[model samples]
Target: MSVRLRLAALGVAAATAAAGLALVTAPAAVALDNGLARTPQMGFNNWNATHCSGDFNETMVKGIADLFVSSGLKAAGYQYVNLDDCWALPARDAGGNLVPDPVRFPDGIKAVADYVHAKGLKFGLYSSAGTKTCNTAGFPGGLGHEKQDAALWASWGVDYLKYDNCNNQGVDAVQRYTAMRDALAATGRPILYSLCEWGQNQPWNWATSVGNSWRTTGDINDTYAKMLSIFKANIKLGQYAGPGHWNDPDMLEVGNGGMTDTEYRSHFSLWSIMASPLLIGSDIRKATPATMAILTNKDVIAVDQDPLGVQGTELSNANGLHVISKPLAGGDRAVALFNENGTPATISTTAAAVGLPKALGYQLNDLWSHKTTETAGKISATVPAHGTAMFRVHAGGAWWSNPPAVHTSADLPLPYPGAPALVQPGTTTTLTTTTTNDGVLPGLLGEVKLTGPAGWTVKATSPTFHPVLPAGRDVSTKWSVSTPADTPPGSYPLHVSTTYYPGKSTSDYDLTVSVAAPLTAGTTGLGDDPWLSADNGYGPVERNTSNGESKAGDGHPITLGGVTYAKGLGVNAPSTITYYPAGHCSAVTATVGLDDEKTGAGSVTFEIWADGNKVADTGLIKRGDPAQSLHADVTGAGLLRLIVTDGGDGNTNDHADWANAQITC
Candidate 1:
């Protein structure tokens, strides 16, 4: 049978088994009605938003859950107040019971659950499939205590459990998580189980039977690359996620630092289109108006929560720039055009590219614009630099009262905003134009028309369309303004126009676009390299840092190089190697350094061996080095050791070293 079919059968068997057990008891017990009522779980997480320092307690949780309801978040389809790491004490009670840190959560889990329940919100906690939980420093390991801990959580009223995998042993991640599934099932509580193994084993196929959602990638930081990387990886797992099970790409970074408003909107829109779990990881208490709009965009959220449950799939991509399309339940489709490029890039997707009819007549609602429009033929929109444009396309005349309203800037273009500057000659450039769209109808699409002087000829044009700009919307399309090779240096006027189509009407802007000298290489500080400023190579996995051991109900005690890193950025590595001193492994060394300096490119490598023979290997990593946060599975028996080295361009001192590594599996 096909792998997909096999996995589906596995899910049926697992669920059926669990159901049978329940029937033998009460006969009425069943999988809790925990399907995400909406597309995205529009809610807040304590980590990115409040951080661990917020000292989230019963009062704090109640307040946040209440805010979710009072502020129309609940009405906007936001649910779940996920409590990230650091809420448990360092040890379990004498009865081997896990206890919340009194100072952080004075009222205990039950009280906090009550408060969240009162606010019409669900509560979620974090754990790991390994011997230690992600918050092991405070809580205990679920490794041997899966059954007890799960039952304990159910007793405390947790409606959702975010099970992460830290200090886990090997590729047996599927089995590790299955243990918890059995445990949680035994508790007789229907909790929304979310697998957080960072996509190590392609959890999409194995986790459906165990969790409501499984993380398809690593933990997400507030940076654009971090978010983009996670999203890009999910393209291959698209077909595996559905209504009850999803491929979580990690929590939303909305309202978090390290990204601009435009970037955050792109983040939200893309996540919505992916049909991934929407657990907000940013603070909600101090959310800005723009952030609020992104968090509660009904149109975008609709795409995520579409009843069709078919996760979005990547259609096309290049140089980090990509396009993903998802079909909606109402015989329509939602398409997200993304430009992950450091410099602006143009991207387009006609209905036909994604298996839809070209003449279906489309409704282009700028997710960021929160408005709608209709197109008879092809509809296109340009993605801005490191930005995204998400649209809800439906059969024209299907969901319209009186063609959607359209408008460009009611205000005229402010006097020519000076001449345009070329950041990359014959490649790309940034152009600015004023419009009166003011976020009305389906925003405006900016376009530039250029004319060359006497001898100078217009070269290939580089276009960047802002996704639902500050007050205007840009149409999605490709630009072609070829420049004459080695053309004479001369001044040129590029005509700029901003077009708008409201409902069934279309408008265009006419203005001057002057060209300036091309920008020198690297002068713009922004170029084609998206990995700029990224770590040059892999580093060592700091033992006790990203690796730990613990028992469920017994707070995890991670001895990081003799110290404890129980807070922010805590310590993460792609993988951790523990030494047990046996078999071929006589000695081990963990080293992280730079590589490819001679070629100006680099990579991170985690090398493992036994008696001079390579035993395990982790490939190149472009994200960061020191081997931090690398996810993989290995094969072998005997001593497990490691050495992390940098293969990317840079200095040798950039390497990280570890003398001993261990494997509990």
Candidate 2:
């Protein structure tokens, strides 16, 4: 089944599963925690600004907390001052309670909380739900002391708690987390709990009842690729997002340097549509004017804080051109037109295309321009290359001062039909639809009639505009026919006609349907895993082999069998490497690159090992070369080993590379 179908099936019981997975206890009733459910969270997290370098001493936090009130952020609806990781010392006091690091937070967390609370803003703190504080610089982990930690936070006046999955792992991840959730409740403090487990456990399906929101992906970097990837990855989880619970794609990367202003606006637009937490990660003290404008765009922010709280959905995509439409409060709709290709292309669609009913008329409000104007019935526009156009459609004058804009459509139903169409059997196709109402009015609807040859049946129906157009609005609709399975493998012409009312404009569009037989495509074996290698002088160097030498990073590969043991496969090199494998393998194992602290890239080779034996070994090598890289294949059920030798072949003493290698997968 499709991923969407799977998620829909799982959506119903997702909360129950979360409740079962979460640690349950009588929850605390802290007064400061009651406001989150009523508003879209607006706050600050230090990770994007300072990362692991985040510090929260009296001097630093007092200044930040003061800035929270003075910087207009508080007035603009930002109230939470969250301290993310790295502020705690290694151990707790004799009372078995976690304590702030004296060097970093000398005044004590309670004092800091008091100061923040006095400023009219709430204070938030971080911790892990595991035995070890998350990977932050010694942030405390409330493993065995969940209840104690929860009480401490409440006593300290914390209004929000960011519970992360720092050192916690294994099958019991759910239970370990639930323990902290229940503990926080016992404190009688209604802290706005947040889950930061990076979505590994599909938190959206079960995180709402436990916390306000959960990170749906790994920490996002300050780059366009990183930001966009996280955004796109959460699209499938849209159904689970709402006012009380949200799917977090991590904090904003707006002014952190990897993109341009337009891109940032696009970023904010998408986030708004997704109803994601508007937690600014940039340094508020030094925010450039441009960055502030992007973050504080009143129009976009309005959409984010919209009362309806419905997340946007992907309407359609053809040949790299994509469209997403969202419903806004006050009978309006938000549409995002995008071009994901290298070249510029025209992305045209009517109000009806997104499912605005015929009874409604819409005015296109350019969010960036902050201007509201009538579309003159011209709801289509061309999108630029690698760019986007975002507009807020206000229904006919209901909420807007002006009327909808109008542009003439000379080629009645432009783009002459009889075009080659690809249709799935048993599925009805939606034809291009449009709306005439321009300003602040509801959507309209027209009739769609389809004519196809005998034997064709309509299994499912769709509007050229998704979200069926609401009634009583001024809108239009087109129709498409679904062909039958027994139809011959040839072109079959079908007709799609629309009848507009009042004005009574009749238009007919033709589509050439091809009943092409489905054919199976050939496949290839698994591609080489980036983690393993069999090149250079490092080929399956058996642990007990005479020629093999045990080296620093190469000593004792963790496992006994599987690709995890591949010789040159370990990444002790300075470069970042991400290890993932195909299939339902139990573990993934590899050794570190044994090269000495020296830097510079060159040929690096390694051998592949499975079940403690050599499976594939490479020839003469070099790093970056297709053939010289580490490659491996191993059973998901067992161990693997690799004994890599640094530099090139025989005779020359190599930098400390791998030798005594083993891995557990």
Tell me, by lDDT, which candidate is best: 2
- Candidate 1 lDDT at 42 equals 48
TM-score of candidate 1 against the unseen true structure: 0.63
What would the per-residue lDDT of candidate 2 be over residues 290-316, giving only the tens digit for each residue? Answer: 888888777787777888776676767
Q: How many clashes (backbone N, Cα, C below 3 Å) per candidate?
A: 69, 97
| All-Cα superposition RMSD per candidate | 14.7, 17.3
The stretch of ten residues in a row with the least summed lDDT in candidate 1 is 19-28
Specify the poorest-scoring 10-residue window by lDDT in model 2.
18-27
Write down the TM-score for model 2: 0.58
- Which candidate achieves the best TM-score against the true structure? 1
Q: Which stretches of candidate 1 lie over 4 Å from their true place?
A: 1-42, 135-138, 169-171, 358-360, 398-592, 595-665
